[model samples]
Target: MNPVRATTSTTGALVRTGAIATVAASAATMAVAAVGHAAGISLDMSGAPIPVTGFGVLTAAFSLIGVVIAALLARFAERPRRTFVRTTVVLTVLSLVPDVIADAGAATRALLMLTHLVAAAIVIPAVARRLAA
Candidate 1:
């Protein structure tokens, strides 16, 4: 009756999404923080390497949060892969807003790019796997 009959089930897909989400989040966060630090963002917090780490961490956290939420939502959606592709593409497009506004400097711009990438990495695979299910 179902086009995607419980091949993988919502729980399985969610778990897969979680794994990818966490890894992508950690990597993107670290990569951006390193770049920001190199660019001299300043670390006002407890004598850290630089204050730029906050922005990087925030960006990654937001992305991870989105993935996590989406992972859960995907569980309920009829076609999670399509939903994920749609969601990621829309968000990625939206991520370009900063560039459009020209509000971010080089470091901010770079961080935004990383955020989009990390989100895509997690969403795409999850969706595909769910669709397979």
Candidate 2:
């Protein structure tokens, strides 16, 4: 195969993997949120309840952002897998800052953090698998 076509194929595969991962992570996060709610963990924050769908929506959005980061790293980084893993891990940890300081109760805050971790755990590995080592 020609170099340009091969590059395009790889990029396409990366996007496909990212899309699947995004859906999986979003669903998983939403499910976690629902389970937490059922277990009497309030989803309330700042005097408002966070809808379970919100979890999936936000997860999908952020997971797409991660996909973009992975694509960029694949194109420019010397070792795409290593850089993607390191960068995303830092980002995942940073994402919990808001949850940690939110006005919600401890259980709610912990649930939010758990959803973030769940999404990250699903998306990071799936996308990273498509990157060059």
Best by TM-score: 2
Give lDDT tens digits, candidate 2, residues 84-113: 999999999999999999999999999999
Deviation in angstroms for 110 in model 2?
A: 0.4
The per-model lDDT (C-alpha) reads: 0.58, 0.95
Instruction: Say what the RMSD of model 2 is.
Output: 0.6
Candidate 1, pairs of clashing residues: 42-50, 42-51, 43-50, 43-51
The residue ranges of model 2 lying beyond 4 angstroms of the native Cα positions read: none
**Residue ranges of candidate 1 with Cα displaced over 4 Å:** 1-9, 36-52, 68-73, 126-128, 131-133
Q: What is the TM-score of candidate 1?
A: 0.57
